[model samples]
Target chain A: MSNEHTAGPHSVGRRLIDLVPHIVLIVGVLIFAFPIYVTLIGSTWDAATIGRGSLPMTPGGEAWTNYSQAWSESHGERASYTPVRLMLMNSLIMALSIAVGKIAISILSAYAVAFFRFPLRMVFFWMIFITLMLPVEVRIIPTYKVVADLGMIDSYAGLAIPLIASATATLLFRQFFLTIPDELVEAAKIDGAGPLRFFFDILLPLSKTNIAALFVILFIYGWNQYLWPLLVTNSADMETIVIGITKMIGTGEAANDWNLIMATTVMAMLPPVAVVVFMQRWFIKGLVDSEK
Target chain B: MQRRVIFDNKLLPYLLLAPQVAVTLIFFIWPASQAVWQSVHIQDAFGLRSEFVWFENFTAILSDPNYVGTLRITAVFSLSVAVLSMAVALLLAALADAKIKGAAVYKTLLIWPYALAPAVAAVLWMFIFNPEIGSLGRLLNAMGYNWDYRLNGDQALTMVILAASWKQVSYNFIFFLAGLQAIPRSVLEAANIDGAGPVRRFWTITFPLLSPTTFFLLVVDMVYAFCETFGTIHALTHGGPGKATETLIFRVYQDGVVNNDLGASSAQSVLLMVILIVLTTIQFRFVERKVHYS
Candidate 1:
């Protein structure tokens, strides 16, 4: 360990010192994952077992029964809306639309801001970026009025339109675009390529990484949104998964069903957790790039 | 041709700004103006034919006794959540930055809560806090501790704060990690060469370098604490255990969503917005200048 004291980036034994923190990190991950692990385990249990918090990893009864109960409550003693299919579809619709639409607009807008020598270029750029300050919380009431007035509430358009144009996306693209050499644009100009042509031809190919990164972030955000959807959608048909899960546990007095509620909550969480694990590389890269 | 040329450049600028301006006007500008308009005029939001009764609602809000308590509770809740979340986030960021092996796994797992729709986080916390079968309850019971958030005001405040801070830590951690990594690696290596001990290096070099990130985080965290905690508040406590966990945004939600008192809610909303704007301006103007980018 002392052999490379004066050397540059030394040996194998020294690397273990760097790894000391990682051992702690593994424990930290377990602590963080405890709630999620509990959610999954609890969901698998029947009502009687879940309340005890003594449910084993594998339940005695059918595993698919909880899944079915969480998905369709009518099959059980109660014949009513459990918010299974309707909310799932609504959330997916809202999230997918936001992802595709925001990314679509971001690509064009970011591409325009990056490749062109347009007038008010910097001013226009900042104008879009400043929307970051307009927290949705601040604007929720008024935005609701606008959505209502537009006759868009409870519809897919209301859920998606206001969020499609993202300041963060534009800023990220502008930052990435800064790294591209101007010589390429100049050469494209000499090759009789218009600004549009230059963007589609020269710039688009170079931005695959950025596009991938942006989609993952925007997708997660769109998927996880709760408040705006809850506010806009009044119809049981239009409720999101999160809202459905909340409604399932309505008021403490009505004999709150722990089994169905936990089961549904787990179902609501699966896709986003999968997104976090799978898209993490792109997620971290996207964040790091924006910081730069 | 010359006459057409005059307006062309000017028109292009507006054309570029048109979509953004349109959406802003539709969503933000109009809503803000409506918020202000509703503040002064007294009217039923859900009912027909709202009449303009100037200053009526504002006076009603100020005089309301419960509102006074609500405001005090809100100020305390939001401020505490901000400070506590920032502190916890800074610690997590430091731990994550220690270049630990599975820190990425920790980072991802910790941040998963942030992605759980605030609504779901609220529901999840409520289940965990359930006295009979909640994990926290069972754990506390096992330890011979009687932790009842429903009957205890102080405990309710503590419980809500813990939940809010838990959700918020990841929000701040991401920013802090970015800020910590932004501190040039070469400079830190230089400090190491000078024989700076771990504690000394952290206090003298790392903390100072991370200040900009910390400051940026403070502002962002404060805003999140103020505005974004509403869904959690609504789901978990509903300003319960005798108004112990009520916050500004929670109060607004109570007024608008529950009481359906549009007028009072609008006034509270306006006041909240004013405080945030003033804080944001000070943050950008004064606090931002003190940060050393290098």
Candidate 2:
């Protein structure tokens, strides 16, 4: 860690070298932040201002007007008109249900895989593991057929349930459960604690952090779901914010209301971005842990 | 990896496993098997009847020039997005890994883009590059450059690629930054004391040490480019001025959902599944091989 040799003659050069990293990082931050910044700024301006091709570098006085228009008004000339308010609620329901449902099922399944010695245990584990290879995009049509067959279309069940079965969350929970000391289980056995009691009393309490981390990750994953919701939910009321935003701009680009569209885009991004930014530590942990 | 002391209750274990098993079967296994079944059987145009035609659907899709073109387009698009995003991310990560002031602030700003949905990312860039109203698009036009993606095939592909890469850079950065920080400071310091310049040290020492992370990210980034960019393409170009931007995955959607060609779409889905499984297997094998190396 010593930099003693740079004290005398080369201090200027060392200072410049130090500045280089900062320069690069600052540029990087700006490059990544530029489009988001532009959108935020554009969302504040009037439709005419944006339509005239004048990019606002600063916030305009029409911020509320733009946001309220996006939120409350029926958007587009399309027949399937749903307010952004309905979409946000639908998105919330979908994201929350998927996150909660995934954690519930995944934790139980992980408990079985980690703590139990049932027959065909390896087979069950591999069955769940194989789901990781087949994303929603691959078998989307047939999956749509399955959901349709169950008459789940246009409901929260259709929007959330199919997505709730996550291989990553189960794997994460399994890894976490495996790290629990054997003494805990032994102690529970000695106390005549049943499996459910031990799980609820001890295991759940110990997994608070893991649960939070997975919640943040899965909430965002569910929120950002576009194709599946777009496929499954045809009714306007069932539209998610992300899907709704795309629908808003799904028409000819020349006729799009850039201001309202940008405003909706901003709204669509807020929850997920907030989850990631506010819960940065857990989000990072969840990402790294899930990938591992 | 099972525990020595385990729960022996027969009914309880099955009860614990039931929900996930049911879901995996109904949603995943069932759908995947249907895709395979449909791939071998083509329904008539009117949807009145269907007959088994083993390998006919696959052979038809394999021989179709448009399908072949889509495969090429996917290769180009995936490779471009991966390389562009990975290069930008590696550069940023290397710089940010230095012990610099406000590094945390910079990192926070950079990583939030990862949270943006692909559709949102596409719209944000689409607005910036919209020919009529986009600031950058207008500026480019004013500069006398013909930069309309709406009419031009190559321009649309380039726009989608940029949007996709922009969204991916943040994710790659997080992993690369973590990898860079995990390298031993002593090894780097030793190189410094030996009169090696930063660039030389980076090439000779830092990069090689970071290969595992780099390799891991390569597979993840490629997979991301392959499947997840659907929103990006769907929102922005919708596969285009003339199908120039339609990836294999997009064709699967277009053919199935839009065109209602169930047989061809199922065949495409099966092909995509094979590609992903092969990619995943390679990734796992590489990971296993790396473990033995260290």
Best by TM-score: 2
What is candidate 2's lDDT per residue for B169-238, written digit by digit as tens?
9999999998899899999999988989889999999999999988888889889988999999999988
As a whole number from 0 to 100, the lDDT of residue B236 in candidate 1 is 70
Report the C-alpha displacement of residue A287, candidate 1, in angstroms: 3.3
Off by over 4 Å in 2: A1-10, A75-81, B46-48, B289-294
Candidate 2 residue-wise lDDT at A66: 76
Q: Give the clash total for candidate 1.
A: 1
Candidate 1 chain A, poorest ten consecutive residues by summed lDDT: A74-83
Regions of candidate 1 where Cα sits further than 4 Å from its true position: A1-27, A52-62, A72-79, A110-130, A252-254, A288-292, B1-18, B44-65, B99-108, B141-144, B185-196, B279-294
True-vs-predicted CA distance for residue B144, candidate 2, Å: 0.8
CAPRI docking class of candidate 2: high
